[model samples]
Target: MDTHEAAGCAEGASRRSVLAAGALGAGALGMGALGIGALGGCAANDAGPAPAAGAAVGGHAPGDAPGRGRVLGPADAIPVGGGQVFVAEQVVVTRPAADTYHAFTAVCTHAGCLVANVSNGTINCACHGSSFDATTGGVVNPPAPAPLREVTVTVTDGQLVLA
Candidate 1:
């Protein structure tokens, strides 16, 4: 009810609005570029990064870059069609194929929300209703509006490893 408190709240709200507007504008531009075949013609990653060389996420190799990822186990530890979630670090490791293991940052790309649920081959963020397909790393539902960051995983001998 005081003038100082009201002013502070107003300032906070304004800052948030500005930030959101900037993000929206950038998204519109990116989408436009993709529509014209200027970009986004490759794999689908809602809010995932463009994969830096040697960047490992939860023991997975990224973008076909030759490097070691995080060690999960002796190769067979992560069974086909199975995955594991690291609560402390907020990352998930899923093996959709016997020789392929995908690790995605448990953090939702949208607003950096932590993904809280993974069911029926989907990762769901509790902060919003953004559901992402664990297998394909694509956005399955909205509210997330972004793609999960892919963590490149490589199996070395038998240990699941990341860079």
Candidate 2:
């Protein structure tokens, strides 16, 4: 090719590279911001006194009570051999046996993302695929490093309340 044509192509390629680098830098910055935000949220969550169970905390599900010591509906809300996630309270309640229930923090100990689902006697965190035992809240998968924090629960008059 002619010199001018080759020079023009080189300039265009350089521009593309510069644009790609700018985009990459912006993406990195965004990811860094996200990491910071996640950590900040974790800190805020840790700073508080667990929101007093029923207080109208941020990210609470609709229809949740708005007072201290949250009332998690009926005791039967958590089916036998299954569990329920109370996102507002950041707690998970599981029933491993008849007339018995276990409660633990839903926050994943690894990265602070709430545990997503529970199945087959395990509370699963979708963020990094960590799993904890539904009955004991013990870590059942890697990357968790610790068991979920146990939350005291009591069933009173057919209603479940955080104790």
What TM-score, computed on C-alpha atoms, does each candidate reach? 0.51, 0.63
The alpha-carbon lDDT assigned to residue 71 of candidate 1 equals: 54
Candidate 2 global CA lDDT score: 0.64
Name the 10 consecutive residues with the lowest summed lDDT in model 1. 36-45
Candidate 2, residues 48-91, lDDT tens digits: the string is 22222223335553222233477888998788989888776777
Candidate lDDT scores, in order, read: 0.54, 0.64
Model 1: how far residue 81 lies from native, Å: 2.0
Runs in model 2 deviating more than 4 A are 1-35, 38-68
Output the TM-score of candidate 1: 0.51
User: Which candidate leads in lDDT?
Assistant: 2
Error of 1 at 134 (Å): 1.3
- lDDT per residue as tens, model 1, 48-93: 2222223343344322223334454565766677676654444667
